[model samples]
Target: MAFRVREFELALMHRMQDLNAGKVEEALHGMSASRAELRAAHAHWTRLAHAPRAPKGAAALRMALGAPPYRGSRPAGSLTCDVLRWPLPSWPGLAFEALLGPGGEVWNQWFVRPEGPMTVAFTDLTPWACVVGDLGASFPGAVQIEGPAPHHWTVDFPHDGRTYRARFVYGLIQRLE
Candidate 1:
């Protein structure tokens, strides 16, 4: 999953470069990717959206609770993708959207969803709650710094009679204990 997302980062970087070069036509107008490619991209993105950030960006988000800060190629930017129409309401339209930020890291990150992020409270998801990735449950605990963590942050939950811990940096999850 990380490998695929890492590759998607490259695709996003190149697209950003083209957009920055004022080549809107090149960025906006391009041959669509294959069905397999689209699935791979989505799989990669989903993992990144809930991973941990790096050391420098000093920005961290709880992967479980919501998407990170980067939805597209860059912060506050958007990306277009050619997705299959068979899955009803899986994403949005041919072009779903979310928000993205650099967070100073690469692999460990998260992004908003088709709509975007929202103000949330951590207390509601911790203590004795269950967070299962299989069911698409996110437990991005509360922000310890009251904002993006300079180094990292964490949230704990009770699942399967065990106390599970998730760490975050740059709005990504590094590990789960």
Candidate 2:
């Protein structure tokens, strides 16, 4: 079967379920999907991701999500890297981004707010409402810490003279600590 964007989103939810099963379940319901569907999507995604014959990097992404709506270049330390972005149905305001190295290897893949000035305040830090980049932009002083597991991240930011830690799975905010 051909992998598609919906399967990509479901695969994302599969990783996110570790942090917020309830929210993932609700999303599955909203998509008119079931746990079995989620599992299958994830399995399919895994196969495509690791298959030796499968397209890699941008080609793979295009195969799954079609041509990206946005493509550009960004600095990656001493090297410049290519960036590709696609909008997802689940998050209208955010975009899924993949950063690729010079050799066309994917360096990172995550959700990011499209270019614009974001005025996110502490009160806006709700679960599943924001991405890691949003907090870094809104809270300039935010410090990133290693997450408890892979595909997870934690950021500590100051608000009202106190610090708060935001936990994320697959770069999407999961909870506030």
Candidate 3:
């Protein structure tokens, strides 16, 4: 039970205020808005709840400036090498294909190694970027992004170098389902 994507856009703004207080279904696009356009889409879902995750040369120009994409399904569970920052060949990396979803693969894959002296801190609960793992390799796992809601990403390998950390604290549930 994981959920994010701004908690399903704030549960679709409380199901659009319980379907405008009358509550019913069947409105695939019958759409209705006002109350100042649902308070500006509820302030764009509270600015996507503190959206961040763009470092290292600006994640490809902040994902081409309109990033809100992720959509590869059928992955209910499996793949959790307990945060896979494996011995990845003692570090000499290059696995960058961040963001695709919307039915494509790679909803995030930034294994940008080369801090050559060990230091990696890719925290999600909101420390977006920190790389300096000075090259030893242990970079681990994290991949869950099927949004409209529910987002996650992890890639670490602290080299046991005595100074590598991780932290992610938005809704909680880093992995292990």
For every candidate in turn, the CA RMSD to the true structure comes to 16.1, 1.5, 16.4
Residue-level lDDT for 105 in candidate 2: 90
By summed lDDT, the worst window of 10 consecutive residues in model 1 runs over 82-91
Give the CA lDDT, 0 to 100, for residue 60 in model 1: 22
Model 2 weakest 10-residue run by lDDT: 110-119
Question: Candidate 3, residues 1-177: lDDT per residue as tens digits?
Answer: 123333233334443343133321222223443444445544544454445742332233232323422222233245321111211221224212233343333444333333232333334222213222222232543322332322322233333454333322121212211
TM-score of each: 0.24, 0.93, 0.21
lDDT of 2 by residue, 85-130 (tens): 9999987888988999999999888888887436688889887898
For candidate 2, the lDDT comes to 0.88
Alpha-carbon deviation at 7 in model 1, angstroms: 14
For each candidate, the alpha-carbon lDDT, in order, equals 0.33, 0.88, 0.31
Best by TM-score: 2
